[model samples]
Each structure stands twice: as C-alpha cells, then as structure tokens.
Target: MLSKLLIGVGAAALCATATISLADTSDKRIALSNNYAGNSWRQAMLASWEKVTGAAVADGTVAEAPAFTTAENQVTEQAAQIQNMILEGYDAIVINAASPDALNGAVKQACDAGIVVVSFDGIVTEPCAYRIAVDFHAMGKVEVEYLATRLDGGDLLEIRGLAGVFVDDEISAGIHEGVAENPQFKIVGSVHGDWAQDVAQKAVAGILPSLPEISAVVTQGGDGYGAAQAFAAAGRPTPLIVMGNRYDEMLWWKEQKDANGYETMSVSIAPGVGTLAFWVAQMILDGKEVPQDLTVPFLTITQDTLEDSLAATQPGGVANVEYSLEDAMAVVSGG
Candidate 1:
C-alpha cells in the first residue's frame, strides 16, 4: 500500500551538500497545474518550468512534464484543470494554486487517485498533499524590521498583492503584525497593486492626494517602481519603497542610487522553485523515501549587491536560481 505522507516545512535556504543514491522509474509522467500567468513574476515562473522540465523530458528523466495554466485566475478554472490532469493519468501534479482551502477538494481527489501532489507558493491545505511553502509572513515582517532601523517613524503607504489570495493575506497579516509591534509607523493609505506595475501606479496615484507625507512605501512585488513613479508624477518627494526582485525594480534602484545615493533592499523567491517541485515529483516516482514538504527560502538583495543582481537578471526577468536533482535530495535529507 502507498503510504500517506504530509510534511510541515520551515523557511530555509536550499541546501545541496548531501548526496543520495536514487531509485529508477524513468517512465513516469508529471504535470504542472498553475493558476495565473498575468504578471512578469508568473511569466518568469512558467519560463523556468519549461527550461528545467524540458531538459528533464529531453534527458528521459520523465516521459512528459507538460505545464498548464488558466486564463482566469479562478478557483473553479483551476479545479477543472486538475480534474482533467487526473483523467489524463499523470503520475504527479505540482501546483501553484489559486486558493489554500478552495482547491482542497480537487487536491484530495488527485491524491486519492495515487498521484503525488506537491504545492508551492500558493499552497493548498489538504492533509494528503505535500507543501513546499515560503515564509511569506516572515518576509513581510522583515521588510518592516529593516525599515525600523532607518527611520524613527512616519506614515506608510501599503501596496498589496492580488486580493483574497493566501499569499496576500499572510504577507499583509505579517506587515500588520510588524506595525503593531513597532507602533512607530502608521499606514495612512492602502491599495491593491495586483502585483503589476501599471496597476500599482494607478492605485497609488488615486490615493496620494489625501494621505500625509509618506516616509516609505511597503509593497508585495512588481509594484515598487510604479509606486516611485506615482510619487514623481504627483510632484511628491521620493520615499523609501521596498522592492520585489524584478529586474526593472532593481534597475530603477541602481539608477536612483547613482543619482541620489538611494538605499533599500529587495526580497522575493525565485520563480525557479517550480523546478524543485519537479524534482520532488521525480524522486517520489522513483520510489525514493523522500520527505513530504520542502522549505522554500526568500532571496534578499542589499544595496551593495544591487548592481550584481541587476547584471545577473534579464531585462524583464526576476532574480532566479534553478535547482538540480542534487538540491532536491538534500532537501529530502533535511540538510
């Protein structure tokens, strides 16, 4: 009988110092079930999956590892996609889900069908599915903690991610928690950036007229530069805006640093964590007794590393690191 496995993971950097022998099952097939692909971050994620899994398929690591994404970022659409992947008889399905609880029913069905289901980023809450989750709460809190060292206290403008998503909720909660603890900073205005530059710009522009002087802007990702743009266009002085790891954001920081000695940090996970999910599925299919969950860490770029990160990043791409099978095994070994 197949053993039911569930794992709870903490946020840590990916470790790959340990090596392990593998079991063989090269005939297995895997599939990626992604919810949305609207923003550059999602676009970069899809590209990473294709590059890594395409190589896996070419090298015969798996028979097929096709990816599917939904046009609308809806739970119903993604559930239907999962059902179809099940009907198609895929051996494993890795998800960047739309909902944590809303997709649990479909996830259960997939697990009951004996398919190895691994979720990352937007993870599911089903007991049978394995999660490779990020410490997004810590991420949000860290942004504030970093800011506390720089400023005494002032009004903050908050830029949120997609509304009603788990990541948005968790990160926002952490930010709020940090604010509560610090008590020095007050959020005077808030808007949903939808994790897009144009959206953030418009939202910030709409709210800027009524708020107090913002000492800083807090963001989810893909919104920092837009926030900066809104401030410039409004003739408001620039504020310390936290950045996501998008290339454009870093590039703008480098430009500002050169012109004004601006200093800030960038925090985000690479889109390449999907590749780690791919290897987890492959290891499971190979009959390796791997751990159920993986800890996905966030990447932070300080002022000193901004130029190097910008150089490493493609014009429209985000800072990224693709994991190898060895990295996956190290995660399994708890290294």
Candidate 2:
C-alpha cells in the first residue's frame, strides 16, 4: 500500500548532506510532464532530464522516459496531459506543474492509480504527490537583501517571474518582506519577465524611457542578462543587478568582474533539480521509502564559486549542478 505524508508548509530547512542509495530494479516506464518550455531555464531543465534519464535507461534502471512539453502555459492543458499520461499507464509521472492548485485533482487521480506523482519547480498541492523544491521565499528574500546592502536602501526595479504562479507569488512576498525590513529600499517599478530573457529585455526596454534613475535591479532567473542588456542599450548606467542561475547571465557577471571588478551573486532554483526529481521517482518505483515532500536548497553562486558553476554547465544552458541519488536523498532528508 502507498503512504500519504503531508509535510507542513513551514518544514525545517532540508539537510544538504543526507545521502540515499539507489535501489536496483527492473525497467519502469516514466513520463516527464512539463508546463512551459519558453525559457532557457526550462530548456536546460529538459536537457538535464534527457541526459540523466538516458544514462538510467542504459543502466537498465528505466525502461522508458519520454518527455512532453505544453504548448501553452495553461493549467487546463497540463491537466489534460496528465490525464492522458494516467490513461496511458505510465509507471510514474514527474511534473513541473502549471499551477499549484489547478492540477491537484489530476495528480490525485494518478496517485490513486498507483502511479507515483512527483512535482517540482512549479509544484502541485496534492497531498499524495511528492514535491521537491527549494525555499522560494528564502530565495526571494536573500536576493533582495543582497541588493539592499549594495544599494543602501535606494530605488530598485523588480523584474518578476510569471504572474500568478506559486514560485512567483512566494518570491514576490519574500521581496516585500525584505523591503519591509529595509525601508530605504523602495520599489520604483515592477514588471513581469515571465522568466524569459527576450521577454524581460523587451519589457525592461519598453519601460526604461519612462522611469526615473534606478539604483539596482532584482530579478528572478532567466532575465538578468536581458535586463543588463536593456540598461546598456538605453545609455543608462547599469546599476547593481542581482542575477539568476542562467549560464549567459553568470558569464556576463564574470566578464564584468574581470573587466571592472564588478561583484554580485546569483541565487535561484537550479534547473538540474529536474534530474533529482527523476531519481526520486525511480527510488519510489523501486519501493524505497522516501519523504512526501523533499526540499532542495537554492543553488547560490557567488563570485568565488561562479567559475566552478560555469565550468559544470554547458553553453546556452543554465548554471547548474546535477544531484546524484545520494545527494538528492540528503536534500529530502535534511540530514
């Protein structure tokens, strides 16, 4: 019988060093269901899945691992896809959900069918489904705090993630929390980047002529480099821009540092965590006991650690590190 574990929203920080061994098992059919594929981060995430799952298939740990991407960013569409996966008799489904609450019913159906359902990045709220993610609230707060120190409580431009998504709301709330503590840091303007570089560049460029001088920019991932490009194109002095964990953005930060001693940090969810979720589902299919909710820490890349992150990542990808079975287990166990 399958177990249901409802982890509290305020669970303790995950231990980043706990380890778990992968169980030897026969081939199991796995399906990856993703909501959006419009950004580099999502692209890198899918790439990681392909690479890791390909290796798993070679080792006989997986029978089949096919991925599906939603054309539109619609919850209804994603729900239909999940329903199809359930009808198709998938052994397990790993989802990057479109909405937290929208997919609960479909996820429950998958769980009831004895199909392991695991959601990450953009998560679902179904109690039966396991969720693997970082503390988005903490991620938001930390980025703003870093900006606050550099700006000394000055005006900031907030480049937000997708509107009305779980991660977006949590990160926005965290940014407000940081601003509450630092009254000197005022938000001069806010806009949605939808977590895409081109989208962010267009949005920021359109608004540049109208807004007053800004001291800093706080952005969700996939758009920091775009925002920087916007500032440069507008002939405005680029303020301190806090970066996300995209490869191009980190590369830009490194170049600036080398040329002018520029310093900033990149804080965001790692795209490679998709691989961790894949391993977790395999563990569950292997009948290994795992947590209902596993929290992975944000990939925090500083100037000192940026080069290593860059080295681990590929060109046109996000700066990410893959987690082995042991590393993923440690994140869930918080050991």
Candidate 3:
C-alpha cells in the first residue's frame, strides 16, 4: 500500500509544530509547473504554494519556489511548460499536470537532467516522477455511495470537470461504477463545467430544460453552488448536490441547512496538497528515500463536520492544510 501522509489538520494549523534537519538541499531551488488556474481551487492551490514555499524560502529550505500556470489547459501547452522548467535548471519541479501520460517525455527530460520531479492532483503516469496522488476514482464512487443513503433511485445529472483531463475521467468513471453497483439510479445528462461556478451555472441551466427530474447532481468539485443556483433560477426543486470544498458552496450548504434540514456532503482534495507536493520535492532533494507513488486523503465535510470545517476555511479559499518537514520524514520512514 502507498503510505498515507497526514501532515496537519487544516490551514489554521499550517504553523509548523516541529522541524527536521534539512538534508544537503539548502542551496537547491524548486519550481512548480502547473497546467491550469481557471477556478477557485486552482487559484487557492497557487496561493498555498506561495504561502508555504515563501516561508520555506525565508527559512532557507530551498533557494526558490515559484509556480507557473498555462493559459490553455492543453497537453502541448503543459509539455512546453515542463520543457521550460527543465531549461531554467531548477533542482526540482512540482507539477499539477495536464495529462496523465502525455507529458512523460518532458518529465523524463527533467529526470535525465538530474532534477527531481513531483506530480500531484492531476498527476503524470511517468515512472521517473514522484507522485502525491489522490484516489479520485474513490472520490467519485463515494459521492454516489453518499447519495444512495439519502436517495434510493432517481435520474441524475452529472457535472464533470475539464474535458480530457484524467482526473475528470477517473472521477466520472467511479461515479458510473457506483451507479452500476446500486443499479437504481441512472444518469440523464452530463456536461463539462470545467470546474468553474459560472460555467457550471450556465451549463446546468442549459441542460435542466432537457433533463428528467434530477435526484442528485453529481459533480467533480467547484460546481455545487452553481448547480444549486441553476435549480433555484429555473424554479426546480434542489437535488442532493455534492460539493467540492469551496467557500461559497459550503456557505450555501450552511444557509440551506439552517433554513431547512437540508443535508449533503462536501469532498475535495484540499488545495494545500500543493504545499505537500512542495515538501515532498524538498524531501527528495533532502535525500530522503521516498516512494515514487503516495496518496493523501481528500477532506470530507459532512452534516456533523460542516460548522467546524466552515470555521476553519478562509474566505474565498479552500479548506487547505500544508505539510511540514516532520510530516515528510514520517512519510519517508513510513511512520
């Protein structure tokens, strides 16, 4: 099994409780080669990198760590970004990749250049690159599992993330797997929301006219509130819409919960998985014997945990949690 790394509780606890001695990497530098930044989660991810890596730099853990994203969420665009990182001569490159395997050549180039490469969230399948992976397939499957408890069988609307991104495919596939296991529910419509609120709102609104009564709107994050908005605007009754951990979505869930005992679950990888990637890259440069593949649990907010999570989250930010040197050491030693 891949080791589970529990760095900290959330952003509020990002303050390092303990520190480990840095390996011979104080002079090294790392760069984040991101593929896209079009949504709240992506924006918060960049912010987390800056927040954690900024402190790491100030403390001389690494000489530098900067994030760069592409204007277009495409394979060639991200491949070019990876190539640029290789040319700049960074000691390590942390990636939220555009494709699972398409950028293997560019990542291999970095590995051949003796540069450490770490991919997270939208991870690459390149064997040479270390991965801080998420169980996105399980993330999707559990959404339907959650719905099954509240909903027996009904028509559904599926709002997916960016088209062609491997994350989207995995999550959607898991949702379908859940439906197959249950056999009571059926998906009536599917659309690409690109993991954006406005895009999701418009897409859901457009499709609501055609879809049969949606019992639950399954999503790939950043689309729950928009789905709710579309239902309200269209004068259709709200369904059990699952949420990604965005502030607005949680807030809307909160309002609905208070007004009536409306209930659903929110789940997503905390955006600070970026900070975990940063520390993992630093650990590799620190000469820690780390596995190439590892997994982190997604944050799930349920009826009972909603208030606490909502309190911990920053306004307009994700419920993120950063990692520390000690946390990385635990992963390295399998503690």
Best by TM-score: 1
Give the clashing residue pairs of candidate 3, or none: none
Clash pairs, model 2 backbone? 15-334, 18-330, 153-184
Which run of 10 residues does model 1 get worst, by summed lDDT? 6-15
Best by lDDT: 1
lDDT of candidate 3 over 231-295, digit per residue (tens): 99999999999999888899999999999989999999888888888888887776556788988
Q: Give candidate 2 misplaced runs (Cα > 4 Å).
A: 1-24, 35-39, 69-89, 148-153, 162-166, 191-214, 233-237, 311-315
lDDT string for model 1 (204-316, tens) is 99999999899999999889999999999999999999999888899899999999999998898888889988998888776666666667777889999888889989998
Q: How high a TM-score does candidate 3 get? A: 0.76
Tens-digit per-residue lDDT, 155-271, candidate 2: 889999999877789888888898888898888889899988899999999988888899888888888999999999999998888898787998999899999999889988778
Evaluate residue 257 in candidate 2 and report its C-alpha lDDT on the 0 to 100 scale.
92
* Better lDDT candidate (2, 3): 3
| Best first by lDDT, ranked | 1, 3, 2
- Pairs in clash, predicted candidate 1: none
Better of 1 and 2 by TM-score: 1
> Which TM-score value belongs to model 2?
0.77
Provide the global lDDT of candidate 3 against the true structure. Answer: 0.86
Clashes of each: 0, 3, 0
- lDDT over C-alpha atoms for residue 229 of model 2: 96
